[model samples]
Target: MEFKMKTEGFHIELPYGRLDISGNEENGFRPYQLLISSLAVCSGGILRTILTKMRLKVDDIRIIADAERNPKIANRIEKVSLHFKIKGSHLSDEKIAKALELTTKNCAMVQSMIDSIEVCKTYEIIDS
Candidate 1:
C-alpha cells in the first residue's frame, strides 16, 4: 500500500475507498484508533466464526475496545481491553469463555501484539 501525503495527513487508496491517517483527529483517522480497531475487529470476527462453528444461533455481536496509551513513551499503546456484547440463543457462560479463549489463541492480530501489547477480553451474552 502506498501512502500519499496530503495537506494535513497521508491518504492511502484501497480497493474499497481512500483512508486518511493523521496524528490529529480532525485531519483524519488517528493511528492509534486504526491499530486498536484492527485488533478488535480481528478478534471479534474470529469469535463470531467460532460461535457459528459451535452451532450457536447468533443474532449480533458488538465489540468495544479501550486502549491505554503511555505518554512517557512516545504515546505508545500499553494495553487494550475488549468488551463483547453478544446477542444470541442457547449461549452459556462456559461456552462463551471457551470461545473467547480460542479467539485469543487464533487471532492473528492478537498473536502479533502478544509480545508488546497486553490484551484483555470480556463478554456479555444478551438474549435474542
Candidate 2:
C-alpha cells in the first residue's frame, strides 16, 4: 500500500497503507497537533491492549495530552506531557507502572520522536 502527499512542488509517499491524511498548516489539526496526536494514539492504543492482555479490568481510560509549543518558530512543539487517568476497581500501582513503561517503550510514534522530544507521563487512579 502506498499513500502520496503533493502540494506546491513538494511530494512524499507513505508506504504504511493507502490511508492518506493530508492537511495544511492552517487546518484545525495543525502539523504539530498531528504529531502529538500520533504519539497519543500510539501510547493509548498500546496501553489499552496491554492492560487487557494483563487481565486488568478497565472501566474507562482517558489520556490527556499537553505540549509546550514554541510560537516563535512555526509553532513547533518542544515538550509533551501525557496524563493518563485509568478508572477501575482494585487497580495496582505496580501494574500501572509496568503498563506505562511498556507503552513508552512500544509506542512507535513516541519512539520515533525520542531524539527531539520529551515525553512525560502522570498516572492517576479515578473512581468509577
- Which digits, one per residue and each the tens of the lDDT, describe model 2 over residues 34-110? 68888888998999999999998889888899999889987778899998999987789999999999999999999
- Give each prediction's root-mean-square deviation over alpha carbons: 0.7, 3.7
Strongest candidate by lDDT: 1
Model 1: per-residue Cα lDDT over 1-128, one tens digit each:
89999999899999999999999999999999999999999999999999999999999999989999999999999999999999988899999999999999999999999999999999999998
Report the C-alpha displacement of residue 6, candidate 1, in angstroms.
0.8
Model 2 clash tally, residue pairs: 0
Candidate with top TM-score is 1
The 10-residue segment of model 1 with minimum total lDDT is 55-64
